[model samples]
Each structure stands twice: as C-alpha cells, then as structure tokens.
Target: MNVDLNIIVFGSTGLMGTAFETVCRKRSISYVGMSHQDIEITSMEMVNNVIERYNPDTIINCVAVPSIDPCEKDPELPLALHCTAVLHLAKECAKRDILFVQPSTHAVFDGLKEEPYTEDDQVKATNIYSATKLLSERFVATYCKKYYIPRFPTLYGLRQNNSMGFVDKVITWIREGRDMKIADDKMDSPTYSIDAAEVVISLIVNNEPYGLYHVANNGCVSYYDFVIRIKELMNADNNIYRAKDSDFSSEIYKPLRTALQSVKLKPIRSYEDALLDYVNTDVIGVSD
Candidate 1:
C-alpha cells in the first residue's frame, strides 16, 4: 500500500481508532482522526459538513456502544450510533461514491453452534446490542454498495479511561491489587487492536473488495484463559483469578463462540503472541 494515501477515521478516541491513529502516525500515513468533539456522527448535518470538508477517499466509522448492559438499558443510544448514524453515513457515502467502512462486532451471532461461525452463518442476535449491530449491517448492505465491513471481536488496545477492553480492565485490576473475576464459559478470539488497525488500513489502502469480513487475532479461548494469559504475561499470581458464567446473561447476552474466521483476508496471527506484544507496548495500560 502507498504510504501517502489519506484516510479519515471516526471514533478516533476509541480503542481501535486510537491504535489506528497511532499506527498511521508511526507509518507517516496522511490521515485524520475524528472524535465526538470533532463531529457527531448521529447528526446528519455534522456528518455532511465533515465529509464535504474532508472529501476523503474513504471514511471509517468505528463508533459503537460496546457496553451491552448500557445498550440494553437504553436501546435508543445504540440504535442511534449503530443503526441511525450508519444509515446516514451510508447515504452520504453513496451520494459521493466514496468508500465507507464500518467496524462491526462479533456479538451479532448466537452461541448455539459448536463450530466457528463463517460469514454465511445465520445470525440470531440475542440482545439489543447485537440486534442493533445487525440492523446497522443490514442498512450498510442495502445503502452503501461501495463499502467494507470488518466484523471485529474484542479488540483490546489502548482504550481511553481504561474503562473498556477486558484485557486492559484485568491488568488494571491486578495493578490495583484486586482479585479478578472472569467468565469461564464465554469464548472468543480476542484481536489485538494493532492487528485490527493494520488490517483495516490494508483494506482501505489496497481498495479491497467491499463486503463483510471477520478481522480478529487467531486462536480461540475462554474468558478464563484470557485472564490467565494476562496474569501470566504480567508475571502476576494466577491465584488472583476466579471464574463464573452463571451471571453472563445478566451482564451481556453473548455468543459462546463467535470466534470468526478471516479466510478471505490474510490470516491473523495468534492471540497468545499478540497479547504479549500488546502488554509490552506502551500503548496499552502499563504501570510506570
């Protein structure tokens, strides 16, 4: 991919977007990152104004209400960002013939299947959050003919306020000398934020085909394994870990194994190694 290509990234303050911006800056790729302070995507007027001003070759919307409980509490908010804002952005992109990319999630599946879900797997969203994301995907498919959709799973990197990212949260708990509680039944292939950003940038710069594709780090593991891995990486005691799955439903109705396969795109590296790199980097929560 050419290094001089310009790209406009939304949700710039988010875990994925922040890592994307950092990668772009490190690579000297000409790009602009936008947060809510820059332009509110929910506002059609603001979306239009920003698009008109930048006229970027591509627009990537990373905005998403990831907290499942919050989404369940207020479905309207997720609908706004995931469905409404997506529709508006799709219309804008269609009108201008510019490439649009929407970063979707793995929650858009039901955990009924025993094997990994392919792109063709039937979607059975079990919660308001997943349903909203599915609605957004439908809208994007219908309106934006020239667009890319990279469905991501648990992207953990440089999350703002350290409020999100299961890995970061676990590290914070350890640093704070708190015991960790993890779900043993829940399963997913957590993607490193850097890997996700790199793949998305590759798709944009390479003018890759416009379609739904999964982008996640390789290797599947339970939440318990994820926690154990983090603790091990931090050189912390494993006894600090505890597991429970009975309350997962009350928190977020998630697919037990929405571990996606990115067979079409270049294969993602293993999460075991990726996690090590992530913890060692300054981007993620590192105790100084």
Candidate 2:
C-alpha cells in the first residue's frame, strides 16, 4: 500500500476515466492514461504492447460502448467492446500478474427488484448493453483471479461530456432556457464521478479484495426529483419542468427502480452536494 505504483487507465477521455485521471494527478500517483486516439482497446496487440510498456501494477478499464440506444439498434459494437475486448484485457492482465479493475453498472440487473441490489444478487440483464456487460463480468470472473468488479449506478459530473449523463441533459436545458421532461417513476442512485474515482483509487492503492461490490451516492431519487434538485442548484426556473416516464416510452424496458446498495465503499457526498460543486465549477455552457 505504500509503494509508488504505475497505473494504466483505459478510456481516459470518458467521464469516469477523466475523473480517474484528475484524481490520480491531484494525488500525485504515477499513472499513464490513454484515450482512443492513443490506442484502440479492441486490438489485442495494442493492449498487450501498452501493458508491457507501462508494466502497471494495476489496470483500470473505463472503456465501454456506452450508447444504450445504439446497442439496442446494433449489438455488435457492444459485444466487441464490452465483452471481447474486456475478456482479452483480463487474460493479458492475468498473464502479467496485474490487478484488473472494471466498473460494472446497475444495468446488469433486470430492474425487477423492489429494493436495492447487492453484489451477490442474481443478475438478469434486460437490454443488449447490460447483457454484454454481464458477459464481460462473467469472463473476468472466470479468467482472471485478481480482479474487482464494482457495479455502480448512473454517474454524472460537470467534467462529464454533454453527450453522456442525464445530469448534463438537465444542465443543457437550463442553459438553453428550454423546458425539460423528467421521468418521475424511474429511480436509481446517482453517484458523482469524483466520488467513484476516489473509491476506485483507494481500491488500487490498497489492493482490495477481489469481488463484486456496489458503490454509489448515499440515497436514491427519481429522474424528476433529480432534475428538480439540479434546477435548484443552478437557480433555474422550476416552472419550465415537466414530468414523464416509461408509461410514455417503448425503448425503456427496465423497472422503475434499480438503486445500488454499496457494501464496500460509501460515497463521500450526496448527489446534490457533488452536483452543486459541478455547477459552480464548470464554465462551459451545456450543448446538445
């Protein structure tokens, strides 16, 4: 736990990856982070070469084809990125005796549970994206002896790209002065990216136990409620908000609630606290 470590992060440009980089830099951790421009993770050759070059004690994989709609439209990319590439990376990491860590999602569940999910709960994926991720988790469990899969809920941060996170969508509506429709029935825990980054960093530094764990912010809230809180933080007019949900959409097949129950790492802030910091710090106007 005391040694200076070399850590390699994949998907360095994505939300979680960016947070991980910022956290590592701020903590003065020796790390090498790579975006897609640096190397394509799907290529085994590239992954192997990078792993050999860096010789990281720990490898955190933040890469994924995160487009749910696109995954539903075409499952090929999800399979390749989430399943195939991750399996290959796990094999390589195992061969090299490196600790592998993957951020799984609450979407791995079918969303039918009445309460929050735990690490040992049965997973019944209801969509292509979750199915692929679940398959990746299975591969990791089978092939790698030293790995941790911490399943998390929706992650958002001001540093997150506008294209991702529902929080960003709300920020965009407020900035554009447009009316926003939020789902009142859809419920899940919203974990701040910084909070998630801290937990992952702690795991890396401590060589934590190898298993699945649930980690997210303190409480759960519906999309409509989450947006209302954001509006209050941004001081946006609440009169512009409308509530809507699964009763209105065909594509959303999951349950009304799927909040995660973290047994290992508790979030540092409530969703609102982290979100307020985000709104105060990020200067860029949200764009569609």
Candidate 3:
C-alpha cells in the first residue's frame, strides 16, 4: 500500500483492534481507531459519519459479538453487529473504493477434520456466532470490490484494560489458590493478537489477493495441554485438573477442533513462543 494511505479501524478497544493500533503506531502508519463508545456500528448514520470524517483508504473492521453464549441468548445483536452492520460497512467501502479488511474466526468449521482447516474447505458453522461470522464474510465478499477476510483461531493477548487470556485465566486461578478443570478434547491453534495484526498489515501492504485466507500460528494443542504448558512455564502450584467437553453443559455449540492453517501467507510463530513473550513482557512484573 501507499505510505500515505489512511486506515480507519473499528472496534478499537478489543484485543485485535488494540494489536492493530499498536502495530500501526510502531510502523508509523496513519490510522484512526474508534471504540464502541465512539461510534455505534449498528447505526448507519454513525458509520457513514465516521467514514465521511476519516475518508480512509482502508477500513479494518474488528467488531463482533466476541462470545458464543451471548450471541445465542440474544440473536438480534449478532444479526445487527455481525451481519447487517458488516454489509453496511462493505457497501460504504465499495462505494468509496476503499479496501475492507475483515477479521474472522475459525469457528466457521465444525472441526471434524483430523487435519487443520484450510481456506478452501467448505464452512460448517455449528453455532450462532459462527453463522453470523460466515454471513459477514459472504456480505464482504459480495459487496466490496476489494476485500480481505482473514479467519483466525483462538486469540489471546494484552488488552487495553490488562485483561488475560485462557492461559492467563489458569494463572489467575492458581494465584487465587482455586482448583480448575480444563477440557482436553477441545483443540485449536491459539493465535497471538500482535502476530495476527502483523499478518494483516502485511497482507494490505503487500496487496495480496482479495478473498478468504486462514491466518494462525504454526501448531495446534488441546485446552488441557495448553493450560498444563502455562502452569509449567509459570511453575505455579498444582491445582489444575483435566476434563472433557462433556464435563460442561452449554446452550451454545462449540467446535471440538478448529485449528487453522494458511496456505497463502507464511506461518507465524508458535503459540508457545508467543505465550512466553506475552508472559514475560506483560505478566511478569505486573500486578493485578
């Protein structure tokens, strides 16, 4: 992309948005980021107003209903945020001839495949969240002339409010002297937000093809093994226990193994290395 290109980022408060902002600042890329408080994405007037104000060359949308249960509880929100709002944004970007970059999830697959999911595989959304995301992807592809949809897997990284990821949740439990049980059967390629951000930037800067792409770290692991690795890395007390998906009951559907691999872009660093970097830089000297 052009060095003078202006990028507008929505959902600026979330993990992915935060990572995008951090990378933009470090690379001296011109961007304007807006959180929910700054703009109501469901409102077309607000969306249009922000786009008119920024007049950006690209719009990176990181907005979505992050969790599955909430989406199931209130389907209307996902329809608005994930589907309608996305269509509106794509239409605007199409009208303005701006590149629309959408960050998607690996949950689009049912995860029955033994190997990692590739971009060419047909999507099998098993839950409301995945359904809405798949719909959004379709809208972007259909409406926008120039678009890049990068599907990512379980992501964890430092946030604006110092929030923790699943691994960090384990650490928190250990610190609180609480017992925890994690699922061993559920598998995914947990991605670091910063690394994902870098890939997105590279995709835009390099002017890659306009289509769906799977963006994730090198390998995959089960939630149980991930937590065990975290405990070993931190050398925390032994309060963690193994469990399975059947151990917990939920109204929402979650894929058993949705680890993703990108055939287009080069593989990013491993989750273990990314987690270690995060722990050392963000967790070591910091106190809750």
- Highest lDDT model number: 3
Ranking by TM-score: 3, 1, 2
The residue-by-residue lDDT of candidate 3 on 208-281, one tens digit each, is 88888898888999998888877776667777788998789985778898999988778889988988887777
lDDT of 3: 0.87
Clash totals for all candidate models = 0, 0, 0
- Candidate 3 TM-score over all chains jointly: 0.95
Candidate 1 vs candidate 3: which has greater lDDT? 3
Model 3 CA deviation exceeding 4 Å by range: 161-165
lDDT of 1 by residue, 1-288 (tens): 338666788888888778788778877888888987788889998888888888787888889896678898887899899988999989888889878888888888887777666788888889999999988889888998889888888878775533566676777787776776688877888888888888888887677888999898887888888888887778776465456777544666656777877768777789998988988775344575
lDDT of 2 by residue, 107-153 (tens): 98877787778777888888898889999899889888889887879
Q: Residue 40 CA error for candidate 3 (Å)?
A: 0.3
**Candidate 3 clashing pairs?**
none
- Ordered list by lDDT, greatest first: 3, 1, 2
> Among these predicted structures, which one has the highest TM-score?
3
Cα RMSD for candidates in order? 2.0, 2.6, 1.7
